[model samples]
Target: MAGLLDIAPLTEKVRVGGATVEVSGVSAGGIVAMIARFPEFRMLMTGKDVDVASLVSMGGDAVAAIIAAGVGFPGDEAQEAAAARLPLEAQADILAAIIKVTLPNGIGPFLEKLTALLAVKGGAEALAKVRATKSH
Candidate 1:
């Protein structure tokens, strides 16, 4: 059997582009509470139809990919190795670690608190302070 065909169905399953943003976003009502501090992350998560459900579902697949890519014979070892010194196994493990927290319950409280914070403070002031202030 061909390997490309193996991934073809999995590819069709994911409507969104990738897992990082989507899954991370889902962990916070699909808004990416972690990204609230970063300007670029703010921009991406500030959208309306961020598709939290899709992200949560796709997260598992993404994490699996990360783990699979870590072994010596990485899934994309040849092409990825050429671009950078990322070992097949190591990079995958790293990616998996980053995505690990995007789980369901893990993000619920974070989303609620983030919403509360955003409601009171909003993004404008959050971006104001250059240094860590007494009150955020």
Candidate 2:
């Protein structure tokens, strides 16, 4: 109960059968990001410029890519190799675009799978529109 990880802060607000139910939704959705697959940007990114600034100003793909990388999620060589295939500059922007598209209020899902998914999704101009809509 007392150690490096604790769910108390997360659960204190809601309950399952009681007030717990309220927190349950938040907990599952929230912790999924934590327990779900995520990777380190340091590992994922080369730290160069690839259109992230323009993308993040819109605040959507920035959120999406961060999600898709699955910082917490450990993937295989194929996964890392797959991520590496992204153009150095476009990596983060790719995620930003995904987050921009699907997210209504939050970016967790977007951040969770932004990059990897985009590589599969494929498209530059289309991605831009997704992220830009957040501002409008």
Candidate 3:
């Protein structure tokens, strides 16, 4: 069989809702979530309007490519090597963990809490001070 195909181009940052979303460093499921935005990828997922088994076969290749590309991760050679050794299933599990932590019920609760916090006495002032310090 041929070696893994290069999928570095797919790792480029994507724009969603007027904000840049990084797919780099995300798990296999996360990469699927990102790349599945493409109509072709979506088709691959559901085997809808396409050859299901053939498309599913591409799944491993795509995930492997994304991991190998090291999308958003810091340049850590050891981590990369370790990740490379992981079976595809383990990689997917790690990605799932990342997605769970990073995307727990969207921003609704977070924004609500943030709004409440900023409303508290000295909250806005404290944030302002931090921002001002960072700007210097």
lDDT (0 to 1) per candidate: 0.35, 0.37, 0.44
What RMSD, rounded to one decimal, does every model reach?
A: 14.5, 17.0, 18.3
TM-score of each: 0.27, 0.26, 0.28
Per-prediction backbone clash count: 5, 31, 2
Candidate 3: tens digits of C-alpha lDDT, residues 83-134:
5566555555444433334434433554346547876854866545644554
Model 1 lDDT tens row, 20-116 = 2212212232233234322333432333222333233334433233333322223453533431443334343344443343332344454456567
Candidate 3 to native Cα RMSD, angstroms: 18.3
Q: List, residue by residue over 1-136, the lDDT tens digit for candidate 2.
A: 5775754332112121222111111223433442243322222222223234633443432234343333322233454455455554444534444333324345444444554566677754444564454334
- How does residue 87 of candidate 1 score in lDDT? 39
- Output the TM-score of candidate 3: 0.28
| lDDT leader | 3
Candidate 1 positional error at 67, Å: 14
Badly placed stretches (over 4 Å) of model 3 are: 1-73, 106-136
Over 4 Å off in model 1, which ranges? 1-84, 101-109, 122-136
Report how far off residue 101 is in candidate 1 (Å): 5.6
